[model samples]
Target chain A: MVSVGQHENIEILSHSEVEEVAGFVGNFKIKVRRKARYVTEDLCTGCGLCQEKCPAKKILSEFDAGLGTRTAIYLPFAQAIPRIPVIDRDNCRYFEEGKCGICAKLCPRGAVDFEQEDEFVELEVGTILVTTGFDLFDCSRVSQYGYGTYDNVLSSLQLERLLDASGPTRGKIVTRDGREPESIAIVHCVGSRDKNYNRHCSRVCCMYSLKLAHLIKDATNAEVYEFYIDMRTGGKGYEEFYERLQEEGVIFVRGRPAEVVPHDGRLVVKAEDANLGRLLQVPVDMVILSAGLEPRRGAQDVAHVFGLSRSADGFFLERHPKLGPVETASNGVFIAGACQSPKDIPDTVAQAGAAAAAAMVMMDRGRVTLEPSVAQANVRLCSGCGECVVACPYSALQLVEGHVEVDETLCKGCGVCVGHCRSKAITLLHFTDEQLLAEMQGALRVLEVA
Target chain B: MPEPKIVAYACTYCSYPGADLAGTLRIQYSPHVNIIRVLCSGRVSPELILRTFREGADGVLVLGCHYGDCHFVSGNHRTVKRVAVLRRILEYAGIEPERLRLEWVSASEGERFARIVDEFTETIRGLTPIEQVLA
Candidate 1:
């Protein structure tokens, strides 16, 4: 996405899954399985004529807020690059009954092709950047907020869409109960700033909450009350914006709301105004809970997949926060977006650009010099217990046919595999026993020379 | 009579410059200490530390930028963890882990670097040689 956005020479094979990454820093061969979208990209006009006539229309639109419905054969989103609709094989009437070819018949450019199978592709790249972004904190986990229970309680992202002119309600500030709210309450730090959930204060929520408050007030002329622990708008121009919202007559309640209860066809929010040292009950027709950012589910698996390290907060670890913000400890791999940390859109974009630049520099160089301290396999020592393979954090070692081969690029030189090799088949370059011992002996010679 | 040998591994960003500062200031400590610079104290692997012991070094000192001052932000965190584990490994091997030391020294700590070397050299002088421990 970065290279393409930067207008660089980039060929993106979409719907591709990387099966294997082999070789080292400057030279890496990646095996990918490109799943056939069953539609020819070059011919599809994206006219939506076929979609209108499709019989199956009840499938959940994953891209939508789930507040909207979509047809079985539909485009992923309006702004999807290819702009071609994908036929959900499971839901397509012809696939289900071997009878209907309505979509194929209706296609103006004859783009649908069911016979397309998954094809394997191999590419050589100097570096790989992983910017697999983050999923929103699931407000369903905080059952006390009545998120899934009450229709009016929506997550911050859902509220974002609700207020968006392009969203399900067409920018109308109406509750799920189909009523325009007279009073709206916004809760801050749903899954964040709490040790039991996410310990870190999700960096963007406070300012975004303020934005929502202003938007809601502007949209519905409703009284807006924001319940927060502290309005941490410390970033550039953020404090001034917070002040602007306050001056705009948005009520700022200094407290983390204790409980949200549905009462008398409305929601009652009970919280303490910590600054005022008083408990108060606020009633509202709509509630927007500003949820926090958590490490995406399977973040550990993704880390394992890319041979990256995650911090205590489960965000991918950067090589150096100051010097190498986008680089990971594992060479050839970079991190960006909320995968590294909870960041606002601007920071995410900036980090994404940095990650792209790092990849571009390596790509432009056409080769990267890997650390010399990579693990090597001694073919003569032939136990092949495969213990070292399991021990390798980077998946650098693999048993091919019978012998083990070390992908020098993938090896991180941690030496855990060397320790695990019972057959003494592994050696770490540069930090080999001989070289380290020599350095040690040279250091110790100070005693005798003095 | 020869001075005791001190193998100092200073992280590149901070402690290495601190040692350099000590040299530039002409703050004379034991000339016995020889320094090896690394990217971070976290980069000072256990293999390197144990090899130093096996090769007959009398003392080893691992110094980093400081708590929260790591060039990699939490790179020193890994250092703290690895050093703790290495200390346990040394103790299990029947070697006194005290011979291996981990310290947080910032870029400005030239005088402190001299003091640390002086104090550590004296400590090594009081103990039996590392060869005796290995034997």
Candidate 2:
């Protein structure tokens, strides 16, 4: 991603958003809001001088999942592209206490700028690809896990940074009190597949939890335990990795943990051993909750920007499940990665390539075929009582000059208007009354024969 | 005695797949149901439902997706209101409103679909047959 952002052809617009999107498949006009970074983009060379001189350094680092501290004028992470640190005006002392200009005073190339404001820009494009990604299901909602209350119990992302070499503890697996854990317990599916939280199994959690188990056990040599309802490692070398972790003497408890409680001066993980038909409480120094993923926050707003629809699961719905995985219901717009569903990195990358290809095909062809099954209003037979207008779910119908009109682009041809029309004036283009009657007859034919 | 005849109008996106899932899961229910799949529950008009009853169907079951989970956005809202009015019309026509039932079943709810069919079938069996009532 850093390499791509640095490419001469690719103009990476960080800290920007799509404010409005207009036009159809082949041609589109986009309005964008480029948020102020409080630092001028062109004048600044990627330098660490401003960061070293900043006085305010206690704000939580969002990139570290809030597990680490960063200076007010700091880059998002060590590996962030463009390497330019944005002055966080909200937390910067110069903006708040008004007593600091150390970054401006100390900069060698005079790159720090504090007087910038947000700007808007518009662009015209042929196609769009949406890959806004996903948000982790907040483990704090499942209060029974005691994620917020218990200091040792951390979310999976928090644990990822905790285990990273560049992280707070410098890659050491230790308790919050700077002591190595004698024992650890990793709980799986804290929010996914529980029916009360999320119905679908977050496909990546099982494998990652197993991977974490391996990493923690190897790093600290702690007696690690994994409490899971099931072990689903359905990927290349994933099942083998699970087997290796098991062979490495990690205790795999076959059940979901009921609760995490403070007991005997340590956190005790309480769960049922379903295979053994017994309840067990395993005391551990630390706990890691393998949380699941949901659609990114503001997913609905993003969908509205691109004229897309979301499925019951709240992920962006595709045009077709198998045949058009990358294509959205809206022509020329495509969706990829975790924004579409909870998938791992490989699946996300593969889908991204497919989405890019889908966009390319539409652009190259310069024309595309839409489904002919659109709603049509018969003006001659129309009473224009506006019943169909009221019943249309898409708002594609309207009373125009005492007759109903259909916006062919917006109508999905669901036939709700046809059913509600008092005059029998509205008809779905392909799925007409005659077609439905034929389908009904065909369905009942077997019963008649029997 | 002849088995009670039922005409079921199921939304193609949710309830129809739910019925197919019931078969896939081997969840047995009454086989007297004649399934007719439509694009949306809102497309199942009172006229079609009434015509089924007039054609000697013992009961009419209109199944759709859940309230907020409608495939056509707010299509099921219209279905809920339409079915309520249809039930009143049946009652005023000297026919039992229990003969016409409206349910919400999703694609993943195979057991719920089977259970709903079994319960609706049993309820219709308890009521006077539509053929006898017309005679």
- By how many angstroms RMSD does model 2 differ from the true structure? 4.7
- Each candidate's interface RMSD: 7.3, 3.5
lDDT of 1 by residue, A1-450 (tens): 344634657576766777777665666788899887777778998899878988887776666567777776788777765567787788888778887778788898998887778899998877888877777888888888899899899888888877767778888889887889999999999999988789998999998999989888788879999998887887789999998998999999999888899899999999999999999999999889899988888786677656576666888878767898998766778999999999998899999998989888987887667667777888888477787676565577998766678997676665556645656677777656566567667767755676
In candidate 1, position A192 carries an lDDT of: 96
**Which residue pairs in model 2 clash with each other?**
none
Most lDDT-accurate candidate = 2
Give the worst 10-residue stretch by lDDT in candidate 2 chain A. Answer: A441-450
> Candidate 1's error at B124, in angstroms?
21
Candidate 1 interface RMSD (Å): 7.3
DockQ per candidate: 0.12, 0.35
After best superposition, candidate 2 residue A379: deviation in angstroms?
4.9
Q: What is the TM-score of chain A alone in each candidate?
A: 0.84, 0.85
